[model samples]
Target: MNRKKKIKQILKQKAKKANDKLNPKRKPRYVSKAERARQEQQVEDQ
Candidate 1:
């Protein structure tokens, strides 16, 4: 039971990895809140 579930999960992960390698998704870069505040401050100062 437990062994079967674990095997299934591993196979699922392998399939997902292969699919992603073939068709990768584009992810936007993340901007932290502190960085955002700094940018706003710079704009206001200028």
Candidate 2:
């Protein structure tokens, strides 16, 4: 019973850590439409 409680505590701690890691909002790098078009044109030309 004590071992089960300990395992539950460890599992809960791990779940909390994983949730913290997964929930944070990440900012993406901004790309301009002109730059994207230029890249696509270069690829097509090649």
Candidate 3:
């Protein structure tokens, strides 16, 4: 039982580390059409 628990703990730690490395910390940026238009307007004004 102890050996099984130790193996499970090790596997869980490895999986968590792999997942953290694979996944980004921040969400992706999604620009809406209105935001894009506003940015374009600002560029034109400059």
TM-score of 1: 0.54
- Which residue runs of candidate 3 sit more than 4 Å off their true CA positions? 27-46
Ranking of all predicted structures according to lDDT, beginning with the best and ending with the worst: 3, 1, 2
Q: Who wins the TM-score comparison?
A: 1
Worst ten in a row by lDDT for model 1: 20-29
Question: What lDDT tens digits, residue by residue, belong to model 1 across residues 1-46?
Answer: 9999999999999999999899967986899999999999999999
* Steric clash count of candidate 3: 0
Give lDDT tens digits, candidate 2, residues 1-46: 9999999999999999999899975887787999999999999999
TM-score of each: 0.54, 0.49, 0.53
Worst 10 residues of 2 by lDDT: 22-31
Better of 1 and 3 by lDDT: 3
Q: CA lDDT of 1 in candidate 2?
A: 100
Q: lDDT per prediction? A: 0.96, 0.94, 0.97
